[model samples]
Target: MGAVASQDKQATLKGSEPSVAPLMRLVEPGMARVNALILEMAGSHAKMIPDIARHLIDSGGKRLRPMLTLACAEACGYSGENHVKLAAAVEFMHTATLLHDDVVDESELRRGKPSARMLWGNQASVLVGDYLLGQAFQTMVQVGSLDALAVLSKAASVIAEGEVLQLVAAKNLATGEEQYLKVINAKTAALFSAATEVGPIIAQSTADMRRAMAEYGTQLGLAFQLVDDALDYGGSSMTLGKKVGDDFREGKVTLPIVLAARAGTTEDRTFWSRTIEHGEINDGDLERAIDILRKQGAIAATVERARSYGDKAIAALAALPAGAHRDALEEVVLYCISRVS
Candidate 1:
């Protein structure tokens, strides 16, 4: 498909009305600059680096984290050019994580296409991911705001720690909600909080505003991940870009499984242990897993948790001034929750 048609396909993946379209509309101009910077920064003489990076970059993610940076900065009255650089940096960090993640997950598809690792090999994917991190840092330095740099740099570390935590926790049925939250907060929410927090930091907004933005992004990130886990079982390949039950196949102990396992009967517990803990998943196992999740109210519970976080994300915006940008930010929280509904 053509570029515009491709983007339209991505936008409509959620249904007749895409949740993120409003946020995209509000941030399109700023996003244009960020996109330009992304392309400029992704260039390299090695050719392989840029080729692999572009394969992922040009893939049809909504660029939600970077958009959060631009939107929050706009809401905080930041007209400075640094926001564009920071937004690009946010995207680089995110893209780098995805590259690394697909390698770790051994995922074949990303955003409805072959993953970078699938085409380029694991070694190249890892090196390209490192290259992206270098580019992300360079862009942050160009902004020349130590505060923004500190927030993002710290987030980069936290994201790595989160990745490690997930690795250690992977396939362990004993993994509780608390451990799971720490994993998601570090891997997912840390970048989000950093993306939004750096905006206010660059704008030199009040401490309260910065804190509020951090909270908003943190909660929103949690909600985003929760919905993603829910979708793995309930959504389609068209929506998720991978086959449904990929997570189950991979033995990831996400929230729905965690909840369902906890509430399961002895027989159900044995089933989880055999499939998730032991990796003995068979054909019909995914369907049985979904039934167990439904019977335990795990799916509904997961969505409820997401809704609670979405409410908190919205509540954080109250500290900011009333305006279209702020309203759009609030809509983003709703948009996130709407994916499951």
Candidate 2:
């Protein structure tokens, strides 16, 4: 399955969308240290630990969450090395979640390659995920900031709750927009918020600055997930790092599906019921689902919602001191939303 965008639209997007080059360049030095720390922490006496960890870590993820921690700490004028440990912890937490998520979603692909669960089996994937989480906490302890540990540990709990909430809500057509937002808020935004918040905590920045960074991260995360939800129905596999209809096929009710199902016709409702609610998907069901989403303008609406959150994220950045890091962070938000444009 592929997206609906044409060659002309892709060409236009190339010129219009913001590039992540600035953020990447700004964080390069810190990310080098963070990368090395990640590898060191992931190592263990058991060879399978590092092998499974390296498989996903070496995969071409953008490492955006850890970069956010590095960028925020620098943006706040921190000159200490604890930020490096914190950044590694953030990445480990993210990797662990991805490993666990593959098992939960029964996903075959991640970052455009076979998932760890597919190659290593579900038991290995789950155990490796647990091992990574332990490493993450141990690294956080090394950071010597109780506040950072509190924030990240709370995020871990919230993420687990969010995953459970999503599992309970799966394939339930009655699930509304509010419940859907709650699910993403816990599942996605919690870690993003924690990732940015720890920067200020480690930097010993002002309370106001910490609040501003937290808000920025939360809004950026919401925007990021919303854009991903849109892309799942309207993007190419190369662009998404997974199949286009994975959400629909898995019976996950994201925002686009909620909006479309709410406004669709009686026959459309029945179609959703059978395919999504009852998991009775047929050969052409994915294409039909995409057509309905397009017809109802759900995809466009989802992108618009993401842009609104992106605006809030940028607004939150205003509280920070002006510098290249701040500007680069804003660009990161734009780059995230630009995936579907």
Candidate 3:
């Protein structure tokens, strides 16, 4: 998640395109099982739950997190079928979070389509999210590993805590890089770490190896989120799945803005205060913000930061066994950081 792959399929950058197919290739069979299980478990008596859940589920995503579970288990030499259940559980947890997050962020679009809250009401989205959470736990229980269950449960709690923390920090320009990192670490990295950790926990691998896998996922997650933050301002709506500048419009104080604010002149600080702190955005504010970020090298710096975490992720993989799965995992970190390129 070891050394960055030198000759893998994902070694070359493709502008804003993320390289996930190699990882997908390595775990295609397992991912198929996870997908089938997801569809089966999404069923409900009410029908609405499946409808709303599938709306986003069917939308194209790389399913990177679930792949990590499957690949990590394979990396740990797990021959059992329990990883399929764990992988599906990871995806359910992710989809549930997306549904709840869209409601909380008041987002209208997700994965290039109408958000669940846009078609269904906020109540429906919230209820469907709860339904998915129940399904996730049910699948986790099916895995029958108490340690895996414990890790996932803690991740669920930490994800909620991260969301609450972000809400508290919203529109607060005083929030610094450290505070923002804490938010993403809990919100995003916790699940990622748990996803990989459960694989070793199920495989009954050494404690050192399990910890290494967890750290690998944690660093990869941090790199992934930082790149996403950069893309929100710099990438297109087609690539980002939502409108560009959504964070700015919503007054989310991300890393780029944090860097710019710290490096900007007094006039730039005033602009930041008006747009991000007070929500007094105007027509050209987004453009101005982008220009300021460019001039201040905020975006470039954020990409550099992501690369650092990607390197750390690769280093963490050193403790895992060497094989195609391990190599694919290393390429994943490279691909994540490449999204910002």
lDDT of 1 by residue, 247-329 (tens): 99888999999998888999999999999889998889999999989888999999888888887887788888998787678
In candidate 2, what are the lDDT values of residues 1-341, reduced to their tens digit?
01222223334444756767888899899999999999899899989889999999898998999999989998998988998899999999999999999999999999889999999899999999999999999999988899999999999999999999999889999999999999999999999999999999988999999999999999999999999999999998888998889999999999999999999999999999998899999999999999999999999999988888888888889888888998788778778877998
What lDDT does candidate 3 reach at residue 294?
87
RMSD of 1: 6.0
lDDT of 3 by residue, 205-278 (tens): 99999999999999999999999999987999887888889999999999999899888999999999999999
Model 3 segments beyond 4 Å from truth? 1-18
* TM-score, candidate number 2: 0.95
* Better-scoring candidate (lDDT), 1 or 2: 2
TM-score, cand. 1: 0.94
TM-scores, in order shown? Answer: 0.94, 0.95, 0.95
True-structure lDDT of candidate 2: 0.90
Evaluate model 1: give its lDDT: 0.88
Clashing pairs in 2: none
